[model samples]
Target: MTRSAGLSEAAVTSLLAGDSVALEGEHELTHRFTTELLTTHRISDTTYNHALQALGRDEVIDPVHVIAMYAAQAAMLNAFDIPAPETNLPA
Candidate 1:
């Protein structure tokens, strides 16, 4: 989906592989924030600081909101025993 949105295949692959150095612009910040959010359940001070330095407050907030919303949706789906559809995209 990200690549279809215009990111290069290399960018998508780098993100999936957890290689932040290969990402650029908002993609880099979002990747860092998402990792912190998923692993810590909250953005850490270091991640928050880096985001503030690289993006505006709203930019930082947007990805956090997106991640949280999707996480909540996934939790609800799992609670109801709903299986996510398989995608043909590379893992």
Candidate 2:
């Protein structure tokens, strides 16, 4: 699905491998914010402020929505015992 959304195969592989630095463009701040949020389940004031300043209020909301939507989808899949699609990438 992400591939169909226009991300390259390599980008998808990197993301699945947790190598966010390999993702396209200068998204270091975004990666940091995501990492912190996922691991801690809460954003620090400093990180939030930095994101607000660099990404603005509207841009900051996007990651939260993406995370929430994906999490919900994963939960539904797990609840229904639905298997994820097979990938051509290496094991």
Candidate 3:
């Protein structure tokens, strides 16, 4: 996470506080990326929500699986060509 952002130690505090626009931007990107990931992995909404649970702490957080799942979902969405975003409940 640290290396990916190209942030120095001094910049970490800002990232943690989300003082930097790019850090907050990462959050938004992550949300969308994770959303697509879950959909593609066939991971149920309930499972995804559970992963968010501090207690559950899913073993999988890597973008490969998450992004693949989401990309699959995106493909489905693209087939439909809908502009609207689907709201989901916690798994």
Best by lDDT: 1
Q: Lowest summed-lDDT stretch of 10 residues in model 1? A: 20-29
TM-score of every candidate: 0.78, 0.69, 0.29
**Model 2: per-residue lDDT, tens digit, 1-91?**
6667566777778888978755654266777888888789899999999999988998899889998788789889999999999977667
- In model 1, the Cα lDDT at residue 3 comes to 74
Which is the better candidate, 1 or 3, if ranked by TM-score? 1
Candidate 2, which segments miss by more than 4 Å at Cα? 1-16, 21-26
Better candidate number, 1 or 2, judged by lDDT: 1
RMSD to true structure for each model, in Å:
2.3, 3.3, 12.9
Give all candidates' CA lDDT scores: 0.82, 0.81, 0.54
> lDDT by residue for model 1 over 1-91, one digit each (tens)?
7877667888878867867677777777777788879988988898898888888788887888889899999999999999989988677
Q: Identify the superior model by lDDT, candidate 2 or candidate 3.
A: 2
In candidate 1, stretches whose alpha carbon ends up further than 4 angstroms from where it belongs are 4-6, 16-21
Residue-level lDDT tens digits of model 3 in 1-91: 6646565654565556645444434443444445555557455566456555522344346654657776678788889996766655222
